[model samples]
Target chain A: MKKKILVIGAGSDVAQALSRLRAERGHILWLTARSQEALQPLLADLKVRYQVEALGFVYDAELHSAEDLMAQLPGIPDEVHVAMGYLGNPDRLDDPKDAARILKVNFSAAVLLMNAVMHAMIEKQVKGVLVGISSVAGERGRKSNFLYGAAKAGFSTYLDGLRNAGFSHGIHVMTVKPGFIRSKMTAGLPLPGPLTASPQQVASAIIKGMKKGRGTVYVLPVWSLIMLLIRNIPDVVFKRLNL
Target chain B: MGTPMSALTKISNWGNYPRIEADVRPWPLQTESPQIARGMGRCYGDSALSTHIVDTRSLNHFLDFDAESGLLTVEAGLTFDEILQVCVPRGWFLPVTPGTRFVTAGGALASDVHGKNHHAEGSFSDHVRWFDLLTASGEICRCSRTENTELFYLTLGGMGLTGIIKALAFYLKPIETAYIRQHTLRCENLDETMAGLEAYGHWTNSVAWLDCMAGGRAFGRSILMLGESAKQSELTQAQSLNPLKVHSTKGIPFPIDMPSFTLNRFTVQAFNQVYFHKHPKGSRDSVVHYEPFYYPLDKVLGWNRIYGKRGFTQYQLVIPHADARKGLQEVLELLAKRKMSSFLTVLKIFGEQSENYLRFPKAGFTLTLDFGISASLWPFLNELDGVVERYGGRLYLTKDVRMNPDFFRRTYPMAQEFMEKIKALDPTGKFQSLQSQRLGIHA
Candidate 1:
């Protein structure tokens, strides 16, 4: 059956891959990004390559209210993928503004958007799937990126609560914990090659998870075990060793 | 969404030679002079290498397409692999494609890459309608045959020295199916191979795999493969049902670099002998998927690792038709005498050259040989360059890493003109590459 899919942060690498995959499956796409200029090309590409309707909406998480953003959509979509994220320089935490921006973009704004989308789905009686892309860094805090991790940890928890609340309402919520994605957010980092997943891998995994109604997904299954080990490490030993 | 952070990273081209540290950033950053745009880093040598690299992979996006006319517009960073996935199912195919589908549209244009069908379709630039180039002055200039005519021709094989190619419009050949009707001819020697290629000139695509290690009478023994895009009517029942199915083979990755000693002369000779005898005698015809027909090597991801950590260089040269036989013979004989082994050797015939200033192909025969890097390889290649120059041949800049300025000037002839034009366009010597600097092509 054909479906309507909404992808927030459409200019992101993972969002682009996910949108392309969904478009290939003959789904109608509503993509939102901060810059319509960046989203226009992707929208045009999807329409041409898949011969599907693809519309674009300019959305900035910091500036736009959740209700206003949701109201701009044509109607309730069959699926909503929240892929927005911010990984500001951890070293710049000395500046409170940077720290606050990271937390708001990753956690607060995501929660508000997902909440609005969930209510819209329920009010319209649409048994749709909602996917939130969190990170493995949320599994446990690390010295290198704890601020970003704390925000993602909050987002992951929020999705867990949403999954419980929406189950009765026939809404499926999924949280994706992707480890070391080779994307713009992690571009400069020296990510472990074997552990890192390409945006396509993450996108495919998310699609599979949505179909299975899995509450949480690790893009690479190994990431589950890796996160387990990191989460279990003794506090003293982990603090002594630099990651 | 936001701009990806730039990083100082260690990078190398497909050949993995002359590895260098470069400031690599996503595309469309503020204009920076002396920066080179790199896509997939598929070019075999220093042509794509520079201190600062504008990574164009993120710019991959389809801008427009006309299903009826087969006119397609796409961002420069779009790869042929991505194009085939979308277009093939719609019965459209690239007008001209290099051996590997991993090449980017921009890279293909800058290199003016030729394919087995060059004798029939010319080079990549011939099918291009126009392109938007981000000039050194940060202005987006639309270049085509009529508009920005001089810049258009100069940029086409300009080695990305003219500016960064942002987007392009080109025509795709409409095909009935995704399969190719292939015919293979086994030739016993150089003369037979040349005759076979000439005999099969009517085919849309023709190329030969040479046994470069063969000596004496067996020299240049090859298998000539000819192909014509298979029509729906030509496919078997099973294929005709899904005649437009695109290639979906996820190639196996080459996990680790083979030890340097694994690619020695003895091993290469044995592999060549086995490969030569694997095919039956005389001519054989079969319908094959375009994947295997056009890109057999792409099946082994990072196959260049076979050359080991020291890396290798591909020496590709073309000699005018009149001197092709002699030039090829001399080059092969020299390699044999030197006891140098090239694991992969290819030969093709090219048709009329384009007016594009620096495009590599001309009315000629071209040969490509890959040699692993070694201390003696440089001097040996220099000697081979002399033989090529004597035969009025020129080396492919896309595959070259160490051709001296004098040799480059003598062979390309239009190097000075290209430099002068680029100078007028980029007066501050912006958009220079290691190759341009090495060959004195910059202002």
Candidate 2:
């Protein structure tokens, strides 16, 4: 069955990979990125490569209201994937404005946007799958990126609640916790080879998880084990060690 | 917008020679001048390396594809592998491709790479309709035959010195199936091999694997492989069901770098002997998937590692048709005399030369030999370069790491003209590579 899918933050690496995978399956795409110029190429690519209908709209999570953005979609999507994220500089925590921006973009904006989409899906009685791309950093906050991790933690908690709430409504919400993705966000980081997953790997995992109706998914299975081990570490020991 | 991150990293091309530490960063959305653009770093030498390199892999995106005319538009960073994955299933194939499908379209244009079918088709640029080049002044110029004609011609095989290729439009040839009807002929010697290549010139694609180590009686003994796109009717019942199936098998990974001593002359000779005898004499016909036919080495991921950590260089040179026979024999004789063994040796005939200023392909017999890096290799190759130049042949810029400026200028008659045009286009010397600097090509 072909799906009508909506991808938020279409400019993101994981989202672009996901969109391509979905388009390859002959799904209709409605994409939203901060810049329509950035989204145009992907839209055209999906349209031509897969002969699928793809539409793009300008949407800045910080600037635009979720209600206004949701209103722009032609139809209620069968699946909605939120891939927007900002890996702000941990060194720049001295500036509260930058810290707030990261928190809002990764957590507040994502929550409001998903809330709007969820309401729209409920109003239309569409039993859609909502996928939130959270991060493994949220599993246990470390000194390296506790600020961004905290924001993702909030987003992950929100998705967990949404998953329970949507269960009664016949809607499925999946939380994706990816570890060390090889994307623009982590381009320069010295990520461990065995631990890092490419955007394509994460995208395919999301699709597979969506198909199996999984509540939560770790893009790389080992990430779940790694996060579990990290979570179980005593605060005294974890605080003494640098992650 | 925040400043993009940059890392001081050690980088080298496929040959892995003369590795240097440079500041490498992703191409900025709004790029500034004076930075060299690199995609996949597949160029054999310094052509893709510079002090400051802008990685274009992030810029990969498909812009458009007109299914009716088979015209596909893609960003510069898109690889042939990515294109084939999408296009082949739809019965469309690249008009021209090099031995490996890992090369980016922009890199292909910059090098003007030739394929097995060069005698039938042409270089990669021959099929290019037009391209959007980000000039030194940050102006995006649409270049083609008529528009910005000189820039268009210069940009092809220009080594990305003229500017960064942003996007390009090229025509894709429609294919009935993905499988190739292959015919192989085992030749006894150089005379027989050359004759075989000419006799099978009518075939859509042709290439020969020559055993350079085989001396005297077996000198230039080779197997000529000819291919034509297999028709649906020619495929077996199992294959006919999915005639357009693209190869999805993962290549066997070359897990570790072999020790330097592992690929010495004796081992290479033994391998070559085994390879040569594997194909039966006379004509043998078979159906093969395009992957193995077009890119046999790609099956061994990081096969270059077989040369070990010191790395190796592929010396690919082409001599004009009139002098080709003598030139090739002289080169092969030198290799045999020196007891220098090149593990992989290939011979092909290119039909006609494109007018593109710096493109390597010409109407000639082109031979490629890969030599592992050794103490004597550098000076030995220099001697070989002299022999090649004497025969009115030129080395492939894409494969070259150490051709002196004088040799480059003498061999490429249009080097001066290319320099003048580039100077006018990029007066500030904004777009230059280590290759351009080494060859004395500057704005």
Candidate 3:
């Protein structure tokens, strides 16, 4: 079965992995990312390795409007995967501009993109899949990365409500919560080695989770239990912790 | 889809050693510059690694098929696994296949890969008909033996420096059964092993597993396997009914990386001893599918993980028939003196060299061995490379990561010719990879 899929934030490690796996399954990809230039190597490799057609477009998610972006799609994607993220220095969020950019990039922009794509699929009367990769940090606020976590938390909750809205319309909305990953996005970070996942593993989990129609997934499954334990701690004790 | 994102990421080849945080470039070019094409990441070393590359696996698809002619035209990204899934049921099979099914067609051609049948059939390129190449100029040139003959020969095993392979056309050997009539023999020394292989080399396919840990008179103790495609008439009544059907073994993957200490010399030597003694000196013919006969290791998926997080290095070198004995003996003695042994070591005899300017095979004997990554690995491989140079034998570029540039140039006389092709076609030298940079093959 050849699927026509749209992948946004295609330069991200997890997103690239997802696109690679989908292409192996014989899907035609339409990719959009912050920089089309950055996508050249990946698209070239995809072309030579999978022998599948993949078209790339320049799309910046920080736009205040998505009408122009939606207008550029070849057609409504059979499935949509959104993997855009902005993990800024947490301490720098004290600056109002930095904080606003973080929330806009991580929260509202995703909400807008999903809202538009979901409606487009609905208008077409297509029973399509919509997946957005969030993070386990969103399960609870943390002192080290609370701003990004809060934004992800908002995005996760938004997906939950979208899932509610999508059910009657026959659209599947899935929220993926990944733990630590050693992607290009997290290179050089002080992340514990054992806790990190490769982009392929995360991508595999996303495909498996979407196929299973999991509403909100903790990738690797164990993360779900791990988050549960973290979320259950009282704020009194949590506020003192720096993890 | 809405966020500010950066562009670098960490990636590694099959070995999982020296993971690099590098930039990635995807095509439908936003920039006029060219990037290297990488398919399936199956190479055991950095031959396929680079700062940025075109992920060719996404392009795998069958472009055209002639059922009657048994000719297949597939995009470079297509894999033999997928090819067999379709062809085997139709009484067709790949002309050649490596031990793993995951390698992309582009990677196969780029390496000019040889299978267990090399002694009978040649490498993969010998069976190729034509291919559409996306050259450095962005022109789609049709290349074949009779058309663009020079480019065709060079690109067959050009390691993708020639350009991205858009599509390849090749002949598929017709088959009446998916099973192989197999014969196995156990030999107790290098002389016995060589004799056993020669005796069975007349079969369609032959391969030998050597006990690298054995020393003294038992130095090359091995299990020699020979097989022929079981003919329809050769099958039993029940087997004849399902002759054309091919079933893959459902593999159990290694769940997690094993600890590095698990595959040290002590364990490999013990295992090698037991394996050597397991089969008594004799021959047996058995009926089996192509899966076990051609790719026994595929039964356990992610078998590489057994080498652990640091990964292992595979040194596969070939020496000419004239110096086969002396060259192999030198290399084996080096490993024995180091008290180091490999878990997997294979020996095969080549039939003839490939026309592909950069293809590695010649009329020779090739030995492939794997050693887990350790502090002493790189230095040891250098010493081995020095020995290979003395015998005029060459290491397989596809399995190389640490070979010296001097050794590569000395072993592959085509370096000058291949460089000329790159200079003429890609004047700017836009296509690149770590291997090219390491060997200084491209500007």
Query: Considering every candidate listed, which one attains the maximal lDDT?
Result: 1
Model 1 misplaced stretches (Cα beyond 4 Å): A93-97, A139-146, A221-243, B1-7, B30-33
In the range B1-443, model 3's lDDT, one tens digit per residue, is 11223355677788886578655544332234546777777888777777666766556556567778877888788788878877788789889998888888888998888998898999999989999898888898999999999989988888888888878999999988999998888888988887777677788888899999888889888999888999988887887888986657478887999998899888998998898778776877788888888878878888889988988878999888777888888899999887778899999988888777887988888899998888888888889988888888898888887877778888998887888778898888777778887888864
Task: Put down candidate 1 lDDT per residue, B204-316, tens digits, no spaces.
Answer: 99999999998888899998999999988889999988999888759999999989888888999999999999988999999999999998989989999988999999999
Better of 2 and 3 by lDDT: 2
Which ten-residue region of model 1 chain B has the weakest summed lDDT? Answer: B1-10
What DockQ does candidate 2 score? 0.38
**Best DockQ goes to which candidate?**
2
Off by over 4 Å in 2: A93-97, A139-146, A221-243, B1-4, B29-34
- Candidate 3, which segments miss by more than 4 Å at Cα? A1-243, B3-6, B25-34, B236-241
Question: Candidates' lDDT values, in order?
Answer: 0.90, 0.89, 0.82
Task: Score candidate 3 by lDDT.
Answer: 0.82
Two-chain DockQ for each candidate model: 0.36, 0.38, 0.06
lDDT for residue B403 in candidate 2, whole number 0-100: 89
